[model samples]
Target chain A: MTGKLAWTKIALPLGVAALLLLAWDAAVRVSGSDIFPRPHEVLRGIIQLIEQGLLLKYVVASLFRVTWGFTLAVLIGVPFGLFLGWYGWAFQAFNPMIQMLRPISPIAWIPVAILWFKVTDKAPIFLIFLASVFPIAVSAIAAVQNMQPVYLRAARNFGLTQLQLFRRVILPATLPQIITGIRIALGVAWLVVVAAEMIAVNSGLGYLIIDARNAGKRYDLVVAGMVMIGLIGLVLDLLVRQLEKFDEVRWGYANR
Target chain B: MQANPTVQVRDLWMSFPGKRSGEQVHVLERINFEVRQGEFVCIVGPSGCGKSTLLNIIGGFLRGSRGDVMVEGQPVAGPDPRRIFVFQENGVFPWLTVTENIGFGLLKKSEPERAKIVAHYIEMVGLNGFERAYPRELSGGMKQRVEIARALAANPDIIYMDEPFGALDFITRLKMRADLVRIWQSEKKTILFVTHDIEEAVQLSDRVLVMSKRPATIQTIVSIDLPRPRDLDSAGYLETRDRIFSAMGMSLRIGENEKEALPISAQQPV
Candidate 1:
């Protein structure tokens, strides 16, 4: 019974995907659009990229930028957010500025990024950081603000020092929410990295799409790049979600 | 048995700022009580009667608007490790295993000492074989046990519980009360418990302090002189419970002469 259930779980999504691919192939054939590639043509395009050794290089380049940018946001945004959350005065003073910056899209910063970094990988990396940092920081702040007051009271009753309270009580209590924030920030980072790559950088999946269209109108390769981005984004999300499985933070999540 | 008092409150008063500016809403008014060393005292009152406010003041989590609160002849400047407060809500660290939570206050102790103490309390609280379980894995009663164990493991001179078992089911609450009495007998720690349940107040306390309604004051302090594991059906138990009920201006019989409720002053223990 267990085996059959697991089989169905895998089979259901695959069945839907297969149907979608068939529909796409039929649409391409009936339309007879020379530029629009069929599903098999996109598959061949992916194989072609792999055979040319460009697939691994491009995928690695995109992932590297996302990693650096997302990691930087986590390192800086989390502590800053925690500080603001802990100190009401700090939040009051800085919240306006954060609120102002948070609404401006990372794509809106592309011109500024180019002017500062000048066609380097840093330009896209900077954009990714800008996109992801606010979500992470805001989530952390909300986590701390919404924490159970009873925990703080209990911690104080135990005579924990301020530093110890932050490290032991505040940090652990807010972790589940902070992790959720990080997951959202990662998604934003992935999105901004692609947009940044399209304009500012000469490598990665985003560049692959633009270069295919500009250089040869290889719609098949463009679709292949798009597919790769979607797949990689899914994998990154799945990896970060695994953090919620830890015993300490598991209480924050609902039981399935 | 009249040893030195562990906690003494002198004409304590507490009030919060009203919704409108420059107005005050009094909670506790001229509240005075003394808890002897190793005594189990329960403060019972109406739902909003400031029993919890009194407990919080004694616990040093909140300062009274007026009056002095002394613990072991020293003023309660703030929450000290020597005294712990158990909240009505589940306060066990969700991230921590049972062992870690119980050992939370033992950060200054050596690893071996902490482990030994945690293990001892786990056994005492009847949480054996569940050392690795987190708060989420435990039942309500078991979680309360973890909290009580945590408070005890801290080795405090006093434990102030604000309706610690108020959220538990009927059977679990009864079992917890018996277990708590057994633990109190063995440990002999001073406890200042606040609850609205008259039966619970009577069942657990050496003395039950009945408080009046908002801007609350101690209406009466009823001494429960019954033995441990006291019979609930006994005349003495029922009399004491009814006295507290009457002291709160409540009629013992349902839909009876509500007008015949005794005045608060008449119910005071001589």
Candidate 2:
């Protein structure tokens, strides 16, 4: 029974996807449109890109920018957030500016990124970094602020120094929330990289879509790029979710 | 009075600022008490009578507005490793397993020593099979046991409990009380426990301190002269329990009229 239930969990989603593809094919055939590509055509386009090695190259390029941008965001954002969360005066001084900047779209930073980095890889990388850092920092700050007072009391009763308290209690207690923030920031980073590449860079999935359309109206390749982006985003989310399985952080999540 | 006092509170007063400016809300008043070495003392009072606040003050989590709390002859300036507090709420670190939580304060010890101590406490708490289970996986009573074990493993001279079993079910609380008595007998740690349950106070402590309502003061201190494995239905137990109930101005018998039983505010229309 368990095996059957598991099979249905996977099979049901795949079945819906198959139905959607068939509907798309029917719509195209019934309309008799020449410009729009069929599902098979998109599949063929992906296979063609694979043969030409552009699929791997473009994927690697997009991933490379996202990796660097997201890494930088985590490294800088977490510690800055911890500081803000720890010191009341520091939060007071910096919070208004963070709140003010947070709501503005990361896409709004595209112009500044281009002006600063001049159409290089850094432009898109900077935009991805901009998109991701705020959520990560804000989540960390909230996590620290919302920590249980009993834990702090317990730590103090143990005679832990301030630094030891942070290392042992504060960090571990807040980590589950921080990991959630990292997951959200990664999604935003993936989104911003695609947007950034469409405007500023020359060789990623986003660029492939724009280039395919402008060069020869290759809608098949465009659709394939979108599919690849969706697949990769799902993969990235899955990877980050694995962090929640750790024994030290599992309590933060609800049991299945 | 045979043993030296392990804890002393001299004229402790606590007050917090009221919502209105220049106004103070007195929570505790002239709180004076002492727990002799290896004695189990329980503080019983009405809800919001500031019994927990008094415990916190002595535990060094909060400061009294006036007076001093001395433990083992040293004034409590702040929380010390030698005195551990088991909170009313679940205080076990959710992120840590039973073993890790029990070993939390043993960070200074050698790895082997810490492991041995953690293992011993885990066994003592009857959590032998759950050594690797996180607190979230345990029931309320089990989690409280983990907390008690954690406090004992630290080798604290005194354990301050603020209604530690208040959250457990009746059966679980009874079992916990029995197990706690067993542990206290073996460990011989001086304990100061606060609870609103008169029966519980009578069951666990060598002395029970009853407190008055807000701006609270120790109204009376009744010493329990019963032996270990006390019989709850015994005439002596009932008599002592009745005395505490009367001291708190409560009657065991329900009033004949329901309306007369309730306060005026509770009698008002919704």
Candidate 3:
């Protein structure tokens, strides 16, 4: 019953989007503009990219960079976040360093990433990691610092050991915040991937964009690549939303 | 020296490190109190007083800078399952169902025993039909009953509640007060409850310990001396309630004051 109530609101918008897709295809055919290719042509372009193995390589390259960078960032960022959130001294130690450098873009890090890592794949990964790390660190810290002290008390009273408290109560309690950080960090990850790929990497959707623009072969292909990036991003966001929903069900708003 | 209470608090002191300034600020001092076996001691004071702090110290949720609290004549160094606590904000874990929460303490018991205990408390709290219901689905009074049942299922000798009903509306709060009194009288568990409301302290407790402002010292402790199933309209209830308020630096203006004592009765409905 509750599920029906939640899903009922989606019916109208979904129908509208389906209707718009039909309208867009018809309008493109009727206009007869060389520039306004049909949506089917874009769909065929997507299939051609896939069949030529070009799309796969770029997708693989982008995924590899994103996955490794995100993993490393989590490895480095979570500890920093947990530490910062746990104590006053941790923040005092890292705040100035993090804040001073935080505002600098991931694109800015591209030159440094290339210089520091010397143009290897590590360079782009490093930039992506840099982009993703801070939000996770900051949010993790915020989550832990803001945690309602009640959960701690509840845990202690329930025979949770110090380790158990951190694992069960503290870690789980900070997860919603950590998830928020991860979600925000994902945007940075995607942004860094495009920028990093454009300058340093030999292949990726970013590379495809720049390469196509230089060739002037098809702006639609460039748009197609951009759309694919956006579509993947939407999936990532939805994945995070689902995870956060599960966490919220397990705890209440993660309280901090 | 007073035959050590089931729960004894001696000269408990706690102070806060003032935020932003790192200044030392005393919150409670010179606090001496005890809760005998099955005793109901209510502590009341003005807002900012350390009533909750004192309760937390006794519960071992917070450490007191001075003195100690003994439960069963053993110094309480940390939280113990044998001593349960119910707080004003929802203490029931949101993830757990009514049955799961009531059975929270029964984890130490054998599986069958745990089930039996859970079943008993569900019936006792009149929550049998709603065993699988999550706390978010229940009304406030129902949630409080589950906590009360949860504590009872643990068979804890004492319950340290810090304004368990303070968040509820007046009607709900009144109903909860009645239900709590009924539960306490039947179970006869020691309860050290903290509140800022004098009437609540008076209606529910055998004794009310009123604390002064921050660096809170126990200004006074009033034994309600009112009988079970206390009549809200009776003179004895009004007198005790007024005394607690006057100690709290306010007199009752909303409710009429009484000067005559009503017949006291110990008979309680099952």
Candidate 4:
């Protein structure tokens, strides 16, 4: 029964997708639509795109854009969040600007990214960083703010000085939330990297898709790049979640 | 000669500003008490009668509105490392192991000394096997024992416990009270305990203080005067319990009608 149940879970989603693809295939053949290609045709094009090395080139470029931008976001975001969370004046002052800039879309910043960094890879990197930074940072800040007052009081009652309190209590408590934020931001960075690359960078998965489309061939490369992005993102997210479990077991802070 | 007193409160007045008015509402009014060195004094009153508030004031965690509290003749300004406080709430930090929690206050000591103190307290508390275990792994009673061990390990001049067993089940609370008396006798340190449990106050205290309501003040101080190893069911113990209960506005007159009840000794402290 367990084996049969496991098979059903996989079969359900697969069956739905297969049905959708069959419908899409039938529609294209019957209607002669140029926009929606048959699943088999897209799969076949993927093989050809790989043969031309076009698929590999775009994926690597997009990966590079995401990697650099995500790293910069974490580097800046974590400490900025910590500061805004820990200190009253910093939170009060920075909160307004944070909320304002946070919701602004990465694509919307394309013109300024081009103007400010001006056609260099930095422009796309900046755009990806813009998209990723706030989710992680804001989550970290919220984590710190949500800490129980008793935890601080208990530390103080033990006669810990402020620095010790920060190192021993605040930092440890904020870590899980910060990690959650980083995972979320990393996902956002990957999502925006394609858009950023299509506009700014000369190469990447996003570049590969757009470049393939511009070449008037190979919808397969675009589909291949999209699949790779989703698969790679799932792997990265899984890695962080596993790390969170390890921390939860070791630290025993949040009881999760 | 009587043992020297460690704490002396002279006309201690503690009040807080009222919510909507300019009035200074009193918690303990003109409170004066002295804890003899090595004496165990438990303050018992109704729940809102500010016994815990007075304990906080003694620990130097709160300021008196007027008058003074002196320990070893020095006035208390804030929480003194010399006086350790064990609160009723789970006092042990959940993240720390039993050994780590016990060693917390002893951080200022030499490493060898801290290790020695931690080992000693762990043994005394019968938690030797669980030294490396986290507080979350321990039961509520076990956690309270760890708190007591930690407080004892600090070797403070006085230990203030605010209903340390208040959260425990009945059997556990009884066991803890007995354990506390044993520790107090062995260690010979001053203890000022706060509880609303009349039985606990009567059983453990060298003196039981009962406080009246808001703008609260000590309504009476009744010395147990019974021989230690105190017998809670003994004649003197029953008498003392009745006296304190009476001070708390409960009449044991119906129960007191029983023939040949223990005679309560109320010595007017000069």
TM-score of chain A of each: 0.98, 0.98, 0.84, 0.87
Structure candidate 2, residue pairs in collision:
none
Residue-wise C-alpha lDDT for candidate 1, range B71-175, written one tens digit per residue = 999999999989988889979999999999999999999999999999999999999999999888899999999999999999988999999999999999999
Q: In what order do the candidates fall by DockQ, top score first? A: 2, 1, 3, 4
Across A1-256, the per-residue lDDT of candidate 2 in tens digits comes to: 9999999999999999999999999999999998899999999999999999999999999999999999999999999998999899999999999999999998888899989999899999888888899999999999999999899999999999899999999999999999999999999999989889898999999999999999999999999999999999999999999998998998888863
The CAPRI-style docking tier of model 3 reads acceptable
Candidate 2 local lDDT, residue B80: 89
Model 2 lDDT, residue B63, Cα: 93
Cα error, residue A237 of model 4, in Å, equals 1.9
Question: Distance from true position, residue A130, model 2, in Å?
Answer: 0.8
Q: Which portions of model 2 miss their true places by more than 4 Å? A: B256-270
- Give the runs in model 3 whose Cα sits over 4 Å from its true position: A1-44, A115-121, A247-256, B1-4, B11-29, B62-69, B103-113, B212-219, B243-250, B253-270
Cα lDDT of model 3 by residue, A94-156, tens digit: 899999889988898787788888867898889889899988898888989998777677666
After TM-score superposition, what is the CA distance of residue A86 in candidate 4 from its true location, in Å?
Answer: 3.4
Q: Who is ahead in TM-score, 2 or 3?
A: 2
- Cα lDDT for residue B115, candidate 4: 95
Top DockQ hit:
2
TM-score of decoy 3: 0.80
Q: Candidate 1, residue A146: CA error in Å?
A: 0.9
